[model samples]
Target: MVFADGTERPCGGLLVPVTLHQRTGLAAQLGAALAAPTPLTAEGLATPKMPGETSVRGLFVAGDATGQMPSVANVIASGSTTASAIVGRLTGAT
Candidate 1:
């Protein structure tokens, strides 16, 4: 797994397994994998975000990070959509 800083960590009780790149593409994939799943709470998974923000300016969020369905196809679609959105937003078009 990978730490937030992109450092590799041990997995499966092994001193080392796969590289961090082999894991999720998002930040702190290791934290997500190790984190215990729980029901969403107002103070937990449902964090607040700034108003009028579609995505952080010039920084787009896609895939599972954006709460979309998880799958290879979904991820690919998310990437394409994010790229299109970014381009459109930068170009000042809807």
Candidate 2:
């Protein structure tokens, strides 16, 4: 996690460092790259799509990129849920 002073704390998994700038930057970059919309909240944070799926087919968002709570538990859960969906699609198992 990124503190207000710009110091970062390391976390587990493939989660990126949680910071407003990084998260917003990721949202913008991914949205532009995928030609998908990254809906933002009033605070300019990216709004989460619950399942971490985007309008772009085969594109998914999870962890800090979702702009949900920047907690390790939440990030892990989001990644797990999104991964399950992706695996289901790949294996033709719902």
CA lDDT of each prediction against the hidden true structure = 0.44, 0.58
Question: How do the predictions measure up, each by TM-score?
Answer: 0.41, 0.51
Candidate 2 per-residue C-alpha lDDT over 1-94 given as tens digits, one digit per residue, 9 for 90 to 100: 7889999999675643433434345545556233222332222323234375665556677676565665789889989998987887689775
lDDT of 1 by residue, 1-94 (tens): 8989999977876453221121343433322222123332111111123211232344455554544334689768767876777677778884
**CA displacement after TM-score superposition, residue 15 of candidate 1 (Å):** 27
Clashing pairs in 2: none
Error of 2 at 48 (Å): 8.0
RMSD for each of the candidates: 13.4, 10.4
Reference-based lDDT, residue 72, model 2? 89
Query: Candidate 1: what lDDT?
Result: 0.44
- Point to the candidate with the largest lDDT: 2
